[model samples]
Target: MNVKQWMLVVCFLCSGTKYIPNTCRTFGSGVVQPFQGSGFYVRSNCPFTLTRLTHNRVECDVSIRRGKNGLLVQVEIIINKVRTVLQNGNILVEDQSVSLPYDHTYENIFQYGIYTRLRSSLLPLTVTWHTVPAGIDTLWVRTAIFIRKS
Candidate 1:
């Protein structure tokens, strides 16, 4: 083969024509209870209500109302099969006074491989939150998820 032919072969091999799986599942939202006045609390048992529907996408939205004191909301997203952590951290919003509200939304791509891995697996993803100020008597949070279509 000539040099030109060899280059063409290499280019074809490196082309981005490979097919990628595009299947994902999503979970619904739920409420999270906050700690009592002037104290710390960890929400490890927070549950994500998942639902199977059209389109392969994942979406989550959380809202919170802090009382007189400020509060911190922590969220974590994980892909169980690959043992990967997509997102993990905390979002802190201060309550200037009573009824301080905050909202957050997240979306991710779920390919075929990821969808299959999570299909029969429990705890495919997890989210957690905690209150900051000890005096903050109220904490409220909600979450949701979506998966893409195959």
Candidate 2:
């Protein structure tokens, strides 16, 4: 098949494929390595701090490959124990599940709860992911945090 034909086929196959937990933007490339993860810990004074009912959005871009063994990827947010913030956001707390397809890129956003406790502040957060079936390697998992100023 020629380049244009191949592109059309891909579009047709990918069309109407609903990815769970939709976000505002998606970008990046490459397959994610199993067990490999990275995240950012924002200090309270960085730029913005979350307040009650406020929105904190996170964008995650991951790539995966179909190896000899299939696997499932799970991503979640980790809040520092010191902080008393409560997450009252979306219930679909995780990203959409994706299957390996000749090494393609996938991206999604997660909206989490803001600080609910009045006495607590300076919340530190991070993103984490793990693969099921235990042995498949993840290419890369990266996260970016955006919070509204209180």
Candidate 3:
């Protein structure tokens, strides 16, 4: 098949394929791991400090190979062992599931990215991820924190 025809075929076949959780590789301080089940849990170490003077931006990149039917992904800022999912103006809806971009067909997989800004006033906050495992399996979930200090 020609280039255009080959591309069309690829897309047609990939639409039914599952997503893949790519490994994390970025500049920041966080962890990217996998978990199972529909329960909620923490994904970071407590007592973590952010940029000293300026604001910090945290990004959560997740890829799903086979998403669960009722999967829900939520994030929280943990402080002193307190679990809080709301930060600044971030919203956590009841059906907050990992949604891949519409044009995410390059690799025949689904990917979701989340960005959140952290103010200096929220220093010493522990950023954690809580999500239900994908329908297939959890591979890699990368979380990056960017700031002048880091």
Against the true structure, whose TM-score is highest?
A: 3
Quote each prediction's TM-score.
Answer: 0.19, 0.17, 0.20
Residue 61, model 1, lDDT: 30
Model 1 ranges with Cα > 4 A deviation: 1-55, 72-125, 131-150
* Tens digits of per-residue lDDT for model 1, 56-112: 343333323222222322222332212222211222223111121222222222233
Which TM-score value belongs to model 2?
0.17
Candidate 2 lowest-lDDT run of ten: 115-124
Worst 10 residues of 1 by lDDT: 114-123
Ranking, lDDT, top scorer first: 3, 1, 2
**What are the lDDT scores of the predictions, listed in order?**
0.28, 0.26, 0.28
Output the better candidate (1/3) by TM-score: 3
Cα lDDT of candidate 2 equals 0.26
Off by over 4 Å in 3: 1-72, 80-82, 86-114, 120-150
Name the best candidate (by lDDT).
3
In candidate 3, list every pair of residues with a backbone clash: 19-64, 19-65, 68-135
Question: What would the C-alpha RMSD of candidate 3 be, to one decimal place?
Answer: 16.0
